[model samples]
Target: MFTGLVEDRGTVQLLEKNGSAIDLTLEISELITNDAHIGDSVAINGCCLTVVEINSGTLKFQAGAETLEKTNLGLLSQGDQVNIERPLAADGRLGGHFVQGHVDGVGSIKSIDRDGEWITMWFEVPEALSLQMVPKGSVTVDGISLTIVECQPATFSIALIPHTLEVTTLGQKQIGSVVNIETDILGKYVQKLIPLKLDGFNERQ
Candidate 1:
């Protein structure tokens, strides 16, 4: 599990393709000589990837076909910047919300506006994934946890402070760029629980 708070930005060093799957190698900015080990899961642009290779400030992971079909990682090119976050440790500070590092669906940047010290970004959510959102609720976009400032039927807006702009990738995101989206964790559970509760009530009736 992750908090959707990006620790740093990494560059795509190399990509070893094998049909639909590929070995993704990312070079971290910090010098991580030996801390990173094999089989460690790291959130890359909100997608949880296991570390297949870890060197000094560089790591490798296998991106399977499922990830390619569902995310924008498949569209990435060499030298592209990617958001990177290490897995949440047992004693780590949970600064952001409970982001599973699971990308629900991909969304496109619809609009971008700058206002004083803040910025507003709107994303057009895909039809299938729009059902699980709520106004002022939690959503993870490209692994950056954000509050749904305004939720429309098919689109949503989020407000970012100046610090968020400097700390994460959302600030540099372009208008037409695609982003990974994960809806609220609690909201999904509520949907499942409500149906079962209503069914039990009907049976009692």
Candidate 2:
């Protein structure tokens, strides 16, 4: 799990092809490198990737075909920047929300408008996952946990505060960029369980 709180922005150093997998190398700040070990998981742009090697301020991980197909990571190159976060500790505070580091769908920046001290970002969501989203509900966009302010047929909007804008990659994001999105894990689970329970209730009825 992660908090969607970005620790630092890192650049992809290299991408090496190995059979059906691609080895990703990232060079992060020393602050994010402290105590991190090989086999540890780091969320890069919202995708949980295992650390295959850790040397200097750089780390390597392997990305399979499935992960590439599900996220915006495939669009990344050697110099692309991504939000990075270490896995949450067992006794740490839940600063953001429960982020599995699993990208559920891909979204595109549709519009960005400033509202006084904050900004309103509208993005397009796929129809299949739109059903699980609601006003005031939580959604993880590129691993940044945010609340849904509005939901449309194919898009949703979030109100971003100054701190959020300055601390994460969203600050530099522009329209037409693709982002990885993970819907609320709790909401998805409840949506699945409710229907099963309803069937049992109806059978009793």
Q: What's the true lDDT of residue 127 in model 1?
A: 62
Candidate 2, position 178, lDDT: 95
Alpha carbon RMSD to native, model 1:
1.5
The C-alpha lDDT values of all candidates are 0.86, 0.90
The 10 consecutive residues of candidate 1 with the worst lDDT sum are 29-38
- Candidate 1: lDDT of 72? 84
User: Highest lDDT, which number?
Assistant: 2
Error of 1 at 161 (Å): 1.4
TM-scores of the candidates in the order shown: 0.94, 0.94
State the local distance difference test value for candidate 2. 0.90
Residue 139, model 2: lDDT of: 91
